[model samples]
Target: MEITHHNKTLSLNSPVVMGILNVTPDSFSDGGQFQQQAHALEHAMQMLADGATILDVGGESTRPGAVDVTQQDEIDRVVPIIKAIRERSDCWISIDTSKAAVMRAAVEAGANIINDVRALREPGALEAAATLQVPVCIMHMQGQPRTMQSAPDYENITQEVAQFLSQRIDACIDAGIVRQNIILDPGYGFGKTLSHNYQLLAQLEAFHEFGLPILAGMSRKSMIYKMLDKTPQDILGGSIACATLAAAKGAQIIRVHDVKETADALKVVAMAVRENHELGE
Candidate 1:
């Protein structure tokens, strides 16, 4: 399958790695590291070299209990970086934001995808996404970022997530978004408990019923650290394991911090899966 964004088409015959670039001061991981123009640009280049098919640029920290930034502040934080990357390469760029203004500005600057954690529920977001005509990744978040994780509960985590995303898909179609342009994320670490996250991951393939590409983002998240009792910086192995599992389970895009490592791990998974298919044939 492929996602067509304007003049670009991203193929999903093989899984793609999306590098995380947080141009913010307080993202959960890698915050305050790429806020500067030079630092962010250099990191973007390195990620490309390390096999990142897409760079996910974000200005706000959506970590639990994080405060929201002003629209202009977010735009200022990400647009310049997006422009710089656009000038350097035509690689796919996914702007990770829920604000309509920021989404519009990022695409104007160079983003090809809108990866909203809120699934475009913010005011004007659905309209902006439809008008932009880029692939939109709608994630399932149970509550607002500031308090999503305080008390996450569900009768059936996987079923609930699927239902939520299904509703969002209809909303997108109603807002004039092309059906094929929609993607789904189960929203790992967003208001989900440890069991809930793992349950969703294990049952990820269930989402394929919608026939949309799944984007799995489990990089350096609390889902790893909280389980292993390690810091974010020390969870590379865990993160890679999650990425590998996601790819093996048919995820189209793996959003990660360790791009090179995840890319290498995915190479092995792809080859094995390919070999298995060949044998079956």
Candidate 2:
């Protein structure tokens, strides 16, 4: 399968790694490291060299209990970095934000994808995404970031997530966004308990019924750290393992902080899948 957006097509024959570039000072991982234009561009280049197919640039931190950043500040934080990356490489760039204005500005700068945590539910966001004509990833967050994790209760986690994503997909389509341009993320840690997170991961393949690409962002989340009793700095192994499992289970995009490691692990998954296909043939 392939994802087409802005006259560019990315093949999903092999799971692609989306390197995380948080240009914010308070992201759960790698925060405050690349807020500078020079530092952000340098790190983005390194991720491309390490086999990241997409560079996801986020100015706001969506970590649990995070507050919102002003729209202009977010635009300022990301546009320069997006422009610098565009000037340097043709690799896919994704603007990770929920604000409509930022989405428009980022695509104007060079972003090929709109990775929204709010799934374009923010005011004017759906319209902005439809007009941008780029592939948009709609994530399923049960509650707003500030209070999502406080009390995440769901009768049936997987079904509810799937239902939420389905409704968002319909909303996007109804807003003139092309169906093929839609991508789905289960929003792994947003508003989900540890058990809820694992349940979603285990049943992630169920989302394939939607016939859209799945973007898994399980890297360095509480699901990994809490389960392993490790801190964010020490969860690389767990993160990579989740990436590999997601790839093997048919995820098309793996969003990760450790691009090189996750890319390497997906390589192994790709090889195994390829061999299996050849044998079946």
Q: Model 1 scores what on Cα lDDT?
A: 0.95
- Reference-based TM-score, model 1: 0.99
RMSD of each: 0.6, 0.8
Backbone clashes in model 1, listed as residue pairs: none
The whole-model lDDT of each prediction reads 0.95, 0.93
Judging by lDDT against the true structure, name the best candidate.
1
Q: Evaluate model 2: give its TM-score.
A: 0.98
The list of candidate 2 runs beyond 4 A from truth reads none
Tens-place lDDT per residue, model 1, 28-100, is: 8788999999999999999999999999999999999888899999999999999999999999999999999
lDDT of 1 at 227: 99
Question: Candidate 2 lDDT, tens digit per residue, 1-281?
Answer: 77787568999889999999999999987789998888888999999999999999999999987778999999999999999999999999999999999999999999999999999999999999999899999999988998899999999999999999999998999999989889999999999999998898888889999999999999999899999998988999999988988888899999999999888899999999999999999
For each candidate, give its TM-score against the true structure.
0.99, 0.98
